[model samples]
Target: MADIATLFVAEGPAAFGVDSYQWVSLAMLVLIGVFIWKKVPGMITGGLDDKIAQIKQQLDEAKALRAEAETLREEYASKIAGAQKDAEKMMEGARREADAILAKAEADSEAMVARRQRMAEDKIAAAERDAVDNVRASAANAAAAASRSIIAEKHDAEADRALADKVISSI
Candidate 1:
């Protein structure tokens, strides 16, 4: 153990001394830093500019689309309003037509009812006239029969012959 410790102590300073390997490592580090400093910032700036341009283009397109949508909405709203007005006009016209038809039907029905009533009244009047004529004829026949019976009861055969002869002479 003691020999091993002594060997390490003897090599430590020699390994740390300025040498060809140290100079080469330092040169490599300086070259890498110089390359990054000269070229990397420009590449980063170009990438950022490209991304910003793309974002601006997308924003302009979105604005255009929104304006177009607003115009379409206004156009559609006006069309819907016109359609509604037309529908209301049609409905009003239909209602007026229906009312006219109903009024015509009512007038026709009233005229028909009046005609029927007049015909019925005429028929009733004719029936009453016929009944009156029949009563008069019956009364006349009954009076004639009563006169004949009274004459037959009052007179004998000879008197009846004499009365008939006289009635014929007078006529």
Candidate 2:
């Protein structure tokens, strides 16, 4: 049984006068020749080139997107600055208008005060004139009463008749 197992052992040269190592080398050479005949290396290199082109195209697209984003950011920043300036201008205009309105209100109030003062003075002057007229009328009435009493005390009926007869003979 041991001899039978040894009969197929690889302890000597292989068939067709070639060793097993030489046959393996020959098989490796034929495989290399077949790969060269099929242009497998060119195909691998061409596939690598195509991948590199695709990656480069993607990189270019990324760069363009980055540039467009930067442009949009700058444009929005300028618009925000312009909006702030416009808001400040509007606030300044409102302040100026408020000041003008306040000044006009003050002027109107002062004019109204002056007009009221003048009206009060005119009323006082009219009251003074009325008081003076009343005093004058009272004085005239007292004088007339005193003169009538004096005339009645000095003159009599006979003196009046003699003076009347003298005046009638002269006419």
Candidate 3:
């Protein structure tokens, strides 16, 4: 116990008065905390303000882009409508032309049919007339042959001459 006391005495005031060092350490910690508290909020607020300004600028750009997109959409819609109208008009024109062509073809066909029918009728009438003339000539030839045979068998020369004259006059 005496040796322990001697060692304690040798350690001196620093060992006996540790409360003062503890107080100094506590005071330094408080001073550092106070310095951080005083300065950190201003720095954080300034950085947040810069970030907010950047966000607002980005939002404005996005709004402008949206407006441009809307304008483009409207313009394209009108163009599409105009193109549709043009296509419809073109189709209508084509249909009308086709109808006209069909009507012309029908008229030409009818005219051709009528001409063919008229030609056929005329040919038929001419053939009928030729047949009647041929039959009449054959009948006359037969009658003349019979008369010549009868005359040669029984009639005199004067009778043959008179018959010939009558045949010529009738013809």
Using TM-score as the yardstick, the better of models 1 and 3 is 3
The candidate, 2 or 3, that scores higher on TM-score is: 2
Which candidate number has the best TM-score? 2
Candidate 1 lDDT tens digits, 1-171: 999898765332234575656767888989978878788767888899999999999999999999999999999999999999999999999999999999999999999999999999988888888888888888878888887888778877999899899999999
Tens digit of per-residue lDDT, candidate 2, span 1-171: 999999866677686988887899999999989888998888889999999999999999999999999999999999999999999999999999999999999999999999999999999989889988889888888888888898789878988999999999999
Provide backbone clash counts, one per model: 0, 0, 0
TM-score for candidate 3: 0.56
Candidate 2 at residue 37, lDDT? 97
lDDT of 3 at 74: 97
In the range 4-114, model 3's lDDT, one tens digit per residue, is 898756443554456656667988989979878888767888899999999999999999999999999999999999999999999999999999999999999999999
TM-scores, one per candidate = 0.53, 0.58, 0.56
Ranking by lDDT: 2, 3, 1
- In candidate 2, residue 143 scores what lDDT? 89
Worst 10 residues of 1 by lDDT: 9-18
Give the C-alpha lDDT of model 3: 0.89
Note the Cα lDDT for every prediction shown. 0.86, 0.92, 0.89
Cα-based RMSD of the predictions, in order?
A: 8.2, 6.8, 9.0
Residue 63 in candidate 2, Cα distance off native in Å: 1.2
